[model samples]
Target: MLWFKNAIVYQLNKDNLFDTQAITNAVNACPFVPCGNTDSMRSGWVSPFGESQDNPLVLDNNGQMLLRLKKEIKILPSSVIKQALAEKVTQQEQLFNRKLKKAEKLSLKDEVYIDLLPRAFSKYQFFWLWIDTVNKRVIVDSSSFKQAEDILALLRKEMGTLALTPYASDTPLEKTLTKWVKESLSFPPIILGDEIELKDAVEDSIVVKCKNQEINSQEIFVHIDSGKQISKLKLLDERGMSFILNRDYTLKRIKFDNAILDKNEDFLPEESNAKLEADFMLMISQLTDTFKSMQKIIEEIITV
Candidate 1:
């Protein structure tokens, strides 16, 4: 009827059962019986009047009665599950780090892509060119090897030849032009400590008025070291009009927003035109040279 109905049962021992009370007197002696049920009765011992079918006796391996219970118990709590998950995550992270280390070890060679636009000529005019460093070949658009070679030779004669050669498949002439300029030209380091008044003229040129004299249509070519590596050049005119030359010496294009300029007096037709050209040309020339030098160093490192 119950889950434990057929389980083995055992009894415990009474003081070997029960103890009787004793009294001593000078002339009389008395004895008393224990009150509660005796251990013998509790120990699965049947009375002489009771039948054995009502109570069955259980024995140990030695035929000795035992009184012990066995039970199924839960030892782990719910928090242990969270701890296990955290340990699993730590193991996964360790495995990922090991894999990354292995990948780093395998990557011994590095290849880099260079942007030729800013490094070659300051103004962007040539649309296409290619450089094959491995083959030592440079190709210009629609030009044969001889023509390309001759052009490069002439450029080198004027501005020294670069250590790196150009490839035929290379596109975007700016890239090759930048490389050549960086390797060949040398520019004097000039630092403009104070802001000079910038003016623009009818002609496309810029004029900067300094303390000493107004530099008008002044052509400033930037070169590094002794070689003729020209990264950028700026032509400033007396009327304050300026022409910015990129690494490739191409004229740079600029966009003017009427909405923004309309709010300021300096944006008037004449003033805006002069200021815009002068400012952009001066800034673009400096930026081109700075970037060109950095590019050359990066290319040298990558190739090495």
Candidate 2:
């Protein structure tokens, strides 16, 4: 319930010029409207807490700000479409005394799509954004770049002149990561994980991935010797929070050890909201503390 499956981080421009008031204005600007019968998809802003729109869309969960974008999509089963298409084709063939032409079949599919949309079930998904204005970074809790882009696009539309850019640096991160492993890089409590991803410079298409093997082992060293550079590297802290840092600054994966549950005992398990808030405070505290070191390392290694 209080978990983020994935993280996609983006560094903001020097002018981090937006706040919850701006976001709330955007949320109120285009409230969610249900998908029309002819519409296959609908997306808009919604309250992070499912209760009321009046509730602040931007939450100050301790220090980390939480914003949510909600989308609804209508589902039309293929089997239903196929069956209807077959029936229509059979009827048309009999009327024309010939097979339905390609164009006619294409038109039929379009008609079927529009007809099925009304009866389709609406599915909802949320894109949770964690805004760290102090750090000038936005973290989307999604694995999909498309979903992450959708959130940014909506914000761009609502809060015009959003000058955020991809997390950048002068030197390539892959080379830095490679050097880290090759040199047995250590940042105290933040150690390199066994897993790594690499790519060839000459042939951008060439890719390699290794997991669960000693990072400094000769087996991996062979790849480094062959000119492979690390594109993504796994990192673990002393507290057992695992991170997968990408070539960009996007944090692809993060896992908290089960030991963290010990801190939750003070909060009653039945209190969902309290539990959520408590967990949020704990999670963010740990994450930001860890990320400070991570940010320092990135700034140092990437020539920021």
Candidate 3:
């Protein structure tokens, strides 16, 4: 038989029952009262002298209790309560383990494949770029940087005083080019010859002067990687004139020319590429770690 020990007894009024708040206040006010072991049992009688006529206490409307004390109230050690709680916690942990093992036995193929299919892409890297020529902008696929810049210039020239911002992606160039495409053509302001001065050149990248005198010139670098489908561009601003880097630049294909027209159907190819596989795997591992953490919480709850 289980030994029931370490219990608390609460004496309450026989009439004018107290609300939960009143009982809680009474418990807090009297530190010597024997409140139950669990938080939920704020006002209950312990069967210290075995079950008798006085099983539960009654409380007044104000949660006041007037009873003659048979003995002085004291804080008893909760050794038996602690032991019972420990046993209950152990049983819960065992149950949680069994459930987790069963879940692991099920297949995860469907979940993984669903999460992989609909290309996950972010534009966090290139959301805000200040262009002197155009009022608004969108990036298109192609190798001709000069043509794209010219189009943006014309658009800026047409839309005077409005802000022209470039839209770029937030992934590594190789992965972006494999699965994304642009579909519209809006021109920008004309590039003035005086605004074309080279500020600085680093390696193969050059900082080109921007047309707006209030803003600093944009730094541009062009580099090619062997396995990359498009050239990578790095933009920089020296003074307060530059916009923050927030998007990634990607291209559908590289065309070697400066006079390509802005009217054609563009499509980004999708293939079984390995460039982004490692990064994707890392993200998946993070999600798995979160799940394990939740399982640990359940184990803790059952044990306690």
The CA lDDT at 109 in model 1 is 13
Every model: Cα RMSD to truth: 45.9, 2.7, 32.9
Which prediction has more favorable TM-score, 1 or 2? 2
Candidate 3, residue 267: how far the Cα is off, in Å: 22
Top-TM-score candidate index: 2
Order candidates by TM-score, high to low.
2, 1, 3
- Compared with the true structure, the alpha-carbon lDDT of candidate 1 equals 0.28
For model 2, the superposed segments whose C-alpha errors exceed 4 Å read: 51-56, 61-63, 96-99, 269-271, 302-304
**TM-score for all predictions?**
0.16, 0.87, 0.16
lDDT of 2 by residue, 1-304 (tens): 4456577777777756557567667767866788998999888876665547466565676346777778899988899999998988898899999998899999999998898898899998877777776676787888877788888888778788567766666878888888878877678778888898888877878888888988888888888889888888888877648888888767767888888755886766567556666776677777777778876886766552
Q: After best superposition, candidate 1 residue 60: deviation in angstroms?
A: 99
Q: How well does candidate 2 match the true structure in TM-score terms? A: 0.87
Tell me how many clashing residue pairs each candidate has: 50, 0, 27
Candidate 1 vs candidate 2, lDDT winner? 2
TM-score of 3: 0.16
